[model samples]
Target chain A: MLVRRFVRRIAQFLIVYGIGLAGLLGLKYVLALSDYVVPDISLILETAKEVIADYIPAVFSTLSVTILGQVISIILAFSVGIAGRKSSWLGSFIRVTAYNIQAYPIVALAPIIFILLGDGFISRLLIASMICYFPLLLSVLGVMAAPVRDIEHFYRATGRMTWQLEVKIRAFENLSKLTTVISGSATLAMAGTIVAEFVAANAGIGYSIRTALYQSDLAKIFVALFLIGIIISVYQGLLETVGTWIIQKTSTEASSHE
Target chain B: MNKKYALFTYILLFLPYSFLCLLIVTHSAQAKEHEIRYRLKWLFNTSVAGDIYANKAGYFAAQGLQVNIKEGSPEKNAINELELGRAEFGVASADQVIRALDKGARLVVLAQIFQVNPMQWIYRDDQPEIKTLNDLQGKTIGITFGGNDETIMRTLLTKAGIKEKEVKLSGVRFDFMPFFRRQVEVWPVYRNSQGVILQDKLTKEGEAVRFFNPAEFGVNFVANSIITSEEMLKEQPQVVEKFLTALLQGWEAAMNQENETKVLAAVKALDKNTDARIMQKQLASTRGLVLAEAEAKKIGAIDMPAWQQTEAIMLQAGQIKRAVQVEKYLQVR
Candidate 1:
């Protein structure tokens, strides 16, 4: 069984990676078809090095703020989502708030945060959290109340033999979906924070990009974009791994019950 | 007989004074309806270093325009604000103006504040291996976003005869300088600010960066343009003329010694962390750019041939898709 599992994993990895690599190569050629015009490559490289050295503290701090902010946002969203699903009043209120946040474009909130936080990290954190919070909340709440008709029957038959039955059995059942919602929102939050940071920051990847553009430094701009893309890509991979594990764990439990 | 004559004279003076007062108040009330809001390209910094001077110095008021300046997201956003009527005017580079005009936005350039592009190239002090653009062959280079900083790379690279894709492009983070220290060949910087900062820090440590100015290579382009909507131009010609005139006067006052110190003070009020000495140096650089066209008959001067030449450079370098008629965007109204 272990040998079979290993072989299957390798095959899956190879197939997915082969397709992805091909796509990346194709995209490069397409961009090259435009001749990939850039201004000040050497200058941009030097400036990027300069900004990184001077603003190392600010960059790390912004990254940490981005991670912590998503954590807080996810926790609050889950709590609110659970409560709303369980209670009618909160459901109405949460529905309204989520819709309101969704109505505004994520980037539009940057200036507001700038006014509140004076081009500070807190402002970026708040704006990013607000943008990501809505999607996470909706996903968690909707997944919790998802139409699994037999789930109620299973609970009825068990007749609350133990509180653990209610907490672990039903909640754990949707764990896969929960991680999906969380991971997606976390990635979205990262993008939102960068955009906010771009408009009102003195330091961070966003500010670096702006300075590069002003100087007509194309190399630095591309480098920044590449880094951001890598970060988001890694986050997505990790989340998908966790999601797969959760789904497998839940599936076995359901089959065992049968 | 003397008391009767004095009372008659007092009544005669009071009637004329009150009537003039009424006329002055009524005219001001009518003018108040026209508020010209401009969205600046950068934050309230030393660039618009003269705006507060313009306001407090009565430059805008003299022209019958109450101008409210706000910060913008710098590019397309500024254009959108003008289109949406959130801002009557927007500030950006001439390239952006060309792009906006192509997008079917009826905009006009009111003034050109920066005489030359401050965009430049930088290398570490005494890095012999990577001294010039030719040295960047087969090396890893850092870039922020390739699209925004359009022509600087193509101009420098093609001039040196470096083939496209010879140098590998790496992801840009705040770590540009680190890449340089760790052996990245070259970097882009603003000569006035970033270059100054690096120069100050390095020079103090007995180090300096080998720098190249894009303008020296015939890449003289304008930065920080003042632009307005065409609809506003048609409807409020008087307001536009008054605003442009006042803004020009404001620049004049800011450049003078006595008022310049005051203008610098206003810049400090907005950003407390910037050093005064640094600002002074920046002011000197700004002065040269602002006054480069001082001899011309017009205050906010536009060079058509130079613009066409820049467009041609980009075109020759295959950066721009097609030749853009530079005159369509610069309607001096």
Candidate 2:
């Protein structure tokens, strides 16, 4: 039975990859026939490889911003989520502040940040964190503040302390939801870094895109965009995998403790 | 006898008072400085040395105008800012001006700055010699696919009778690693700005760099020029004239050998990113491009033939909807 399942998995993988490869080839052929792209296959392949190789620094720049921003976001989310449940006015005020921050357009704010921080790596980090902070905070705060009525009643009837209820029951109950919100925040983090880079960056894919626009090099623009897409996809995938691992490991520990 | 003396004194006072009133009115009219915003094509650099000099040296102030120089980024469109009335004057290349005109924006060219477009391809000295356009064949040429450089390169290829398949066209970004690593043979740059900086860097690393300027091969794609909307020209022709005159004076002063130190100091004050050494070279390159040809002997001279050729090239490339009477837009002083 195990052998058969393994074979089936391999077959599925092959089929999926086969379809993807076929689609790429079709697109390449169409683009080659048109006036938009260079028609030579070997040249196109070399260009792609060179672009990817050259964009490593940009990839790292993006990742550094995303990782740092997400770390700051997680801390903010937990603090806001826990504290917000204590008082209705505090919750309302915090929510309003978050909304205001999110509402102010990044384009206007980026230049201000650049001026304040002088276009350093730290400025990019701060810009990314600002964008990532709100969504994660709001989502986590909402889930933690409003547990299901049945769960709330059960914990209260059992005479559980507020800390005990939060730590043992509510936290586990919202683990998956928390992970989902964090994953979404990662997406916003990528966008924020790029926007900040566009305003005042010495390096990164955003700078590359800006330079490409000046030269009217459509190919460079496409390459930069393609790399960005791949970076975001990899980020989302990692978030998903890490979230799944945490949930599984925590669930196992809880069951053993019970 | 006392009444006659009083009448004489009152008449003398009235005549002097009238002359004083006339003098005040004329002085105020001449002294009123029009506050106008001039949008630059890019951030503060050697590219905008003249604009900086004009602002810092009180050239605009001398002309009874208060000009605010606003820097632009990749996302900021100077022409669009002009259309929206956010700026009175702006800098744009022939490509941008053509595109704006194609979209029905009534912008006029004030003065062409660079005698030749600074856009060119830079290759290492060790690479194949590119003395002529035909030499680009069988070579890997880097282009920003939708950029003006790409348009120019494509045109060059067509003119040289070289097929696209004959050469390798690669995409490049802001990073010079691809060119350095030999993945791309020729890379694009603004000859007077980034070109000088890149060449110096490469040369320092023991790799000398040479540029493939399109003008050498007879393709003159116009670069940044002083631009303003028709509304401004029609409503405030005097202000426009004063501004242009002062700006031209600023350019002439900036290019003068005696004023190099002042010009460099003014440009450095605005742009703090570039190295002083690189900036000096860049300034020299800028002077060369801005004041190269015979027509450029008079700073800010409008080269009508170049503008016409630029428009024709754009039309041929299908970059615009129709041929614009390019001369109708140029208001040469």
Candidate 3:
């Protein structure tokens, strides 16, 4: 299942990336644009070959930040979502604050972040977490707030209901959705880190992209995008596989207990 | 019913005729005016005072040309716009032109605007003056990696026979905190624009600052220049001549110290955010760069040796794969 999922993700990314490249090439041909504007396939391939070695290390640096940021965002999102699941005023306040904080664009806040934190790992991580946190929180909140009425009623009537069991039941019932949201947020985390690097930081693939832009080298940019897309697809696929295993393991345990 | 149908047919035929007439009128007007788009290399500031002056003072109109002077940013590359058929003419740095040419972009240089490149380093007056290239040794200098400043700085260091480890090279962003905190002893800035602002701020704080111009140290990397597609120059040679003449005239008049106040007012209208005092100083600094005493009459002369040196510098720095023989592209009117 894991191998199949990984293969499927990689195939899907290649197809989409191929189509995008074809579209760009079509535009270039129709317009008769020089390599400076939209590079030909040969130029892109040559540039990719030239830059791949240097870019791999940069990509790994970005990937490391992306993984760390996603982990941090997931923890924060789950905590906030679970706490804000109730209908109390405190819960409402927490939800409102999360929404408001997410509304402020990260680009606008980046300068202050850089000033306070400097353009280092911390700022990139902070920006990445902030970017991916809100969406994950929204998904978690939706799942956690909706009660499993039929199951919850049985426990409540028998006076055996506890918050821990209640939370587990809700999470278990919505396991698929939680997994999807967490997996999807990885893309946002990657995007956030790239933006942080593009805007200020001196390292990472995004910084390389920025340098490529300075020289107006579209081929290098194309290569960078290809690597980023491939890496993120693999990551999302792994997340889904892990999620499937967890779902299968939990269901088997519950059946055995019964 | 038959009479009504005949009247409807007549109305439809008349509509087509009217549309054709309108198209012809617009075409004729455009032909008479010779409308073209001129993309600037940067935003509206003292750096582009003459460009602003040209439009405001009706220089293009005087030459029977209708030019839409578009402001430019890093993303709004003139070469791309030219290829995309969006702009007929533009201002690009020598490095950009050479790089574009290396990649098969058919661009031509019409004029070199800045005799002295405005990209320079600023340091506190208290620091030891870098009178010699060796004086740069051990100084923590800031350069925007992947920018022309970085190439120019590297070339300077190489000329001084200094290794990379000899001086601490700090990569800078748009932020100036590192420079302000004295963590980076030298910072790169456009001498006319950011240089003026920084100097003004430091001056107000009872501190003096000095600019270290690369040109002074014999690194004559060319800056901004007027450029057009090779096709435009070939097909519309007359129009190109008219546009270049009017642009050079606009630059000449704008740089004349006598027209300083009028030029300042024109620039102020476009750039409302900059302080009036800073704008004045920026324009004064720009005048010297744009029109050195010997080249005062020829505001837009193309410096051939500087262009060759610029190409050489880019080649040595690996900014370009090979020399594009940039001289072939420079069409000095």
Candidate 4:
């Protein structure tokens, strides 16, 4: 039954995506008939070749920044998230700060960041981390503090240490929520990395977009976007798989123990 | 045993001395390579061929300088970057310099790259000719809202006795489809780079394109010029001179007929998308703009009269509140 359900889900996704891809391909041809520049498969292939040869370094740079930022966010989320959930004062402070930081768009802070850090890998990394920082922290905190009566009574009755209760019991109970937050945060970090690269980077996908805009080369711009989309999709897909496996394993373990 | 202990002690002493010498050598080597950051007015293209060539051709390295060239977007203000000390040197247009001066950003112009501003309106030749500014009336023209093209177009319209209502100003957002579809009769493009590409594309579709140059009609808005913060000028005079000298040499080499292949190769490294054939034509146009009918010796020359005229035009357009002594900011060699 489980395998059949999973197959149905996969088929549903493939059908939807297949239709979307076909529609896009049809649109490309329709536009091509006019004087409008449209993306061709050959152009995409050529662009990919060029990017692999000349722009792979930038792709790696952006990935490195995103990975580093997401890792930092994971650390901050685990530590500060718990503190925020456990202490009312700390939680209020974290909420207010995160809200303020997230409210001010990264574009507005880019100049100040560029000034403070100078335009380099460090600035890009900071901007990416800043963006990824808040969402993960808030989600983890919210999940940890969620009032589940049964779990709460069990922890209290067992007289477990606060650390053990929070780390083992609470985290497992909220494993699925944590997984969703992490994947979203990772995507946010990728976006932040691109934005940072756009504002002040010397090289990267964002820089390529900027250059393409200046030249008004729509083909090159689309190519860069296509590459970036592929990258983000692959990264998110990996995260999703790992997240699902962990959630499944942990939930199964908890149910068996119960 | 006593001799072995003495030898070990001597080895330890020599290691420390050698390590100290290595540190001194490394520090001096690093010091020799004075790191400087330069920000461009626009992204990497043939427009910045000279600057990129300077770095790529070992001119900066030859001068014992390590230069980091940062590309700028339409949203980026090179003058602001210079003012904030994020970049030691930057490229700015006459309009931006005027605005920066009015806003109290102490920047000095180093070298004017494009002697003739390449910001011009491109129209399909099949359409009615825009030979005079009056011909532009009633036609939809594309302009980037906050760009130098907008400033130049506004100045020209005012000078031509055309009101805002007389001409339809369409705000362009990096999309050429509107222009291609004849939604905008005229579109702004850099004659050297984007203009060449546009013209080629249209020609392939059996449409001939012509550029309406503002300089030809006496507006003569100045384009990209090298700019450095006042503080950099005051403090690092030697470094500035060294950088300028090497940069000028690079520009000269890039523009030279014999070095076309080498220069274009360097440009292709930075701008991988532009076609080599189109780049050749763009390079030719770039050379014409930089030289501006002057002798080869006049490469990177600051056209003071042109600068004055540009400032006067900006003032007339009310782009700046007060008249700045533009001459005072020019550091022409």
Model 2 root-mean-square deviation? 19.2
Instruction: Report i-RMS for every model.
Output: 22.4, 24.1, 9.9, 24.4
Location of the lowest summed lDDT over 10 successive residues in candidate 3 chain B: B24-33
Per-residue C-alpha lDDT of model 1 across residues A1-258, encoded as one tens digit per residue: 444544554554554444433343343343221111222334345546755564455455556666777887888886786667654777778878887878988666676666556666777778778877888878877765553457666777767535345435446767766777777776678876777677766557777667655533444565566455545555556656767777888788779999
Candidate 1 regions with alpha-carbon error over 4 angstroms? A1-258, B1-32, B128-143, B165-176, B179-182, B293-299, B313-321
- Name the top TM-score candidate: 3
Q: In candidate 3, list every pair of residues with a backbone clash.
A: none
lDDT of 1 by residue, B37-132 (tens): 778876666667666567767899887778887776534356656654567877877666655554345677888776666666666666665545
Model 1 chain A: weakest 10-residue lDDT segment is: A31-40
Worst 10 residues of 1 chain B by lDDT: B24-33
Over A61-144, each residue of candidate 2 has an lDDT whose tens digit, in order, gives: 877887888888789878887778555899778877877888898888887777666556887888888888888878877777
TM-score order of candidates, best first? 3, 2, 1, 4
lDDT, residue B119, model 2: 93
* Candidate 4 pairs with clashing backbones: none
Better of 1 and 2 by DockQ: 2
Measured by TM-score, how close is model 3 to the native structure?
A: 0.93
lDDT at A178 for candidate 4? 84
Off by over 4 Å in 3: B1-34, B293-297
lDDT of 1: 0.64
Worst 10 residues of 2 chain A by lDDT: A31-40
Tens digits of per-residue lDDT for model 4, B142-225: 886545687789988988999999989986644477788798889999899889899999999999999999999988778888
Residue B213, candidate 4: alpha-carbon lDDT: 94
Q: Which ten residues in a row have the lowest lDDT in candidate 2 chain B?
A: B24-33
In Å, residue B35's CA in model 2 sits off its true spot by: 1.1
| Residue-level lDDT tens digits of model 4 in A1-258 | 445544554554454444444444554443222101234556456656765665666776788899999999899878887777765787889877877878998888987887666567898889899889988888877876675668677777888646656566778777888888898787799888989887766567876676555433345666666556656666766777789889888778868989
Each model's fraction of native contacts: 0.00, 0.10, 0.58, 0.02
